[model samples]
Target chain A: MSSLQLPILWAMLCLYVGAFVLDVYQFFQSNEKVKKAAVIVTVLAVAVNGILVVLRGILIQGLPLNNGFEFGMCFALAIGIIYLILLKKFALSQIGAFIMPISIALSCWLLNLDMSVNPLNPSLRSYWLSFHVTAAVIAYGTFAISFGLAIAYLLREQGKLQKMPEAEVLDEVSYKMVFVGMPFLTIMLITGAVWAEYAWGTFWSWDPKETFALVTWLVYAIYLHIRLMRGWRGKKTAILSIIGFVAVIFTFFGVSYLLPGLHSYIS
Target chain B: MHKFLRSLASLKLAIYLLAAMAGLYAVAAVYGDMEIYSSWMFRLLMAVFWLNLFSCTVLHLPGAWRISRRKAKADFAGSGYENIAQAENCSQDEITAVLKKMGFKMDTAENEQGICIFAQKGKASLFAPHVLHLAILIIIIGAFLVSFAVSGAVICTDGQKVALPSAVAAKIGEGYEIVVEKFETVYDDQGAVDNWVTTLDLTKDGEVVASGQSMVNHPLIYKDLTIYQNSYKYHFLLSLEGVNAEADGVYSLPEDLAVDVSDDLTLIAHGLSDEEVFVHVRYKGEEQTYTLILGEPFAFKDGISMEYGGENNYTILQIKYAQGSKVVFLGFIIACLASVMFWSSRYREIYLRQAKDGAWQGRVYCKSPEIMRKMKEDFETNLRGK
Candidate 1:
């Protein structure tokens, strides 16, 4: 079963790439049919990705969020899932052009990396590993979706001042998405700290990964404060959201690669 | 004092302190000496910094200052008195529209619940920074308490009366002493240790008391203290005997001329001639042959340097003993439990309000859907069933 699932995952990866290209093409054409088709393709890709994860889990006898490669794949899959849910709820199909490419790029990056499978170490035999990493990936995925929404919000705000379609709807959608993502991010941070304590005997050792995650949390906190207390909304809020997401990106990728710590396993 | 008490309880203060602390921690991680900064001290500093920052920021002093400056300019333009007050009192939605005219996008809505606006991003996670800061403080306090006030170690050896360390012994009450009756270890064919067991008797005086066996990973607990088999070492004993072949007289015999040494001896001797004796010495299972003068003793040089290889045939005997030590295992268990709790239990609350029209309408909020879904499903099921 495991062997069979590997090929299916490869096929899913190809479909994601195809959908990403179609979405990029639609971005230039500005045709509703093309855009709708892109959305359908992305949904199909998400379904295939979901099936792949399920099959892999059944074959491995557990959730496949066990190692670094699996973690990367899971994170990409989560981004796809978040995109689908938000796209349906907000009717922000135009942003699909941006999101699909980002998901595909991340997935392709994972596909090209060294994908070695090894048995879990005795220390990782606990159930906490699954709970902690899965939560973190989902949180990251939500943040990625919010990042795309923030970009759209900024563009729509700019378009609106020029007496264009009121981008206020887009702004609201972006704000709502970020609001949803924030609590998840908080949970991720908490779970991560707890898991670290269990595995390494210290809760917050200021390991580079922990440090970056904290920074990302702080950036979002700043954004939230400005929005709620000072009545910051619109383009300025969108800009701050973009900045926070950039920090999130740095935390997720740059820290893992540039700084060697307990999380070196991700590298 | 009333003002101070109110300020102390302010959520704004908490937010400020949390942010400041987070900023300081980031700086400390980058530049400050981690070795000099205790975890507890860092946590405390962080908590204070964030609380103050959040309080100051939330008070909107900076925004008020900007608004006051703008009002001064508007007054200088000779606007009517009532109009100035009205301008100052502009509803949040009108202010949002003005902001939108300035190329800003602000989303505002008014309901009976009062007017509210959400900025384009990160407004929802605004509370996370403070929550994380508080959580970190708790974790640090828990860790500090466990490491300092509640942790101790105990050591025991086989067939020996072992006293607890002075620090721990003082707290262990009055009527208990630990005696290890026998400690043994089993090894595989490849010489790797398979398991170790320590049979211990807890005695008040010298009577046969409460007894238990402790092995690797599985420790024996008595009261608050636990005993674990930590390690073992080998001890050997050797014996040597001597015979005077030259002191013959009437009792002289050929067999009595050379002494017989037991296998326990470090050195063995045989009189090959009147002037010399041949000696066979063993140390750590390796044998060395030596010739000794009639009255002179042979020296064996090693970790244990010996002066005599006996004259006449001698016997050497070797005996081996295994010594084992056990330590209190509670510390390990506590550390594991603390880790599990810290990682798994993240506090999150989801508020869902259904519309009066009997349709499913609500907000889903949580850190991970994996955790949130179970709750969401339960709530949904219960609500639908009703």
Candidate 2:
């Protein structure tokens, strides 16, 4: 919490790296024990990451969700938690092989970010800040899972059509995952707009962040419509869902850093 | 009526509504940045956008109709439900027929519990889309109404009595005038402003009613009217000195000071002194002829630069007017509450059925599983643990 607790942080970092290595090994080896070991490592790393967040929050008197560094760390933790739950529920042990590495990469990226604490502005003092930001993080985490599913879906579709190892199952799982993700993304959009209206004078200010969020929402909306109305199944649906998640990534990181807007907190 | 309402609440309508909103917002973004766009026109366009978006979200009848028609067609085709027998020793035609009879238009079975069916049911899920959109529209309308119907600003100097604008005055309801008892500004050591404070007295028919001091970001509210410190500027006093003699007559000592005699010769004064011979000058528009003292400087107008002994000097102090309203604040609160309700209160249901063989089969569905996962996990874990 005091920024000098490097030992604990370093240990977490080591575990994160180990988890990534184990996940990669499981992916290639296709061993059930290796896969289970990867899941356990991921769960442990996520728990440690959760403790880091809680300690930071305790020191700050609230969650460290005020800036990009904190957001990246929190997002990584959320994704780790989500991946573990999905792995346990669907017996999707292979996903951890990919998800843990992504989580580690994000955590490393967070470490590189500026860790300075910014004083909360008067407008951000409302209780809604927690609600708004927490929802956004959860929504982003869902999209990340959807992205992974889409990639798996595309790969599986290619493999199945080529008389490969029944990758069609991957496409189904991706579709189901996206179907799960869409609603949270919708709620995230609605909540963000509401928060904007309260803090600023207007509901929609046409800020770059707002615009990109709308674009992201549209991409997913198109994905849903294609899936529902056109009966788009298989690899094609997987590809579109993946494209939707890419748009979400652009909205979250690209818009915040590359585009100028009222959401200058990230900058 | 029930059928109509159900159609209106369909998911298809929600998608259309969201798409339309995105399109309109794109248009608004383009137009909002153009200086040539009139404010009134911009406001009108915004209002139309809000109305269309809100209507689409709130009205579910059209979606219900589309879904119902799709359902009727599926029924006619005799494809409506799960064709469970298709898995074992069934021809393609027989499989298709059984699927049709089971109310499934198209079906694919993966594994034991993974059955993907394309059939139209639970049209109520469509209502979720409308719910989000309608909430947004209501927030916009509420804000717009407050902006147009009930907000105003008033400017008053120290000891000045000003009538509040009609928009705010009428709402205050008879027998009240606002008086600025005093206005003061505090500045930091760096000469930057720290804050502006205005002492106000609300009077009723020449008698003092209520009085309080309001500062920047701190508003005073009375009878649903709120006032905030908006902004301020500077006012200055000026004097002049020194004189000189010109070819026509006596002129100012400052060579730059201009004097005109019969519009032929004009004398300009450069500098003036207070105890020296000063030039007496009169302009065509002057009501009282005054002498310009030597070695002294005076401001000619509200903001005019003057030089004295190779140095420029100016004096002015600014006074600010505060503006605010309770209606806009109320709208903000409502919008926040609406957002929380819309995002947090999600309605979802999962249908699970056990096959005759006692194998567990189910579909898990929700608006936002990411947000609901903690709850879902807790339930699953607790159930399993028990």
Tell me model 2's lDDT, rounded to 2 decimals.
Answer: 0.55
Query: What is the C-alpha lDDT profile of model 1 across B86-198, one tens digit per residue?
Result: 22334444544543432322343444434333222122233333334344444444555444422234444446675554554555545556677766655544454556566
Q: State each candidate's chain A TM-score.
A: 0.88, 0.89
Residue B319 of model 2 has an lDDT of 22
Off by over 4 Å in 1: A1-10, A160-166, B5-19, B27-33, B36-44, B47-386
Candidate 1: DockQ?
Answer: 0.09
Candidate 2 chain B lDDT trough over 10 residues, lowest sum? B313-322
Q: Model 1: how far is A141 from its true place, Å?
A: 1.1
Candidate 1: TM-score? 0.55
Give one digit per residue, the lDDT tens place, for model 1 in A160-179: 32221246666666666566
lDDT string, candidate 2, B1-386, tens digits: 55564465455655655555555554544344533223675566556556555454445546645553442111112222222221333333443454344333443333353323233333444454455455456555655654444545666556778776666666666676778777766554445555666788878788877678766535455554555555443221123222222332222233344545434323343323323332334434553223344345545432322222221211111121212223434444444444344333334333323233433332334444453454345434433333
lDDT of 2 by residue, A1-267 (tens): 567434445666777888878766754677768767776777778888888788778766787777676777788887877777777666565555445666766776666766655555544544556766786677678777767766665665655223212455555566655656565565565556555544443445577677767766777766766675566767677777677666666666777776656776764
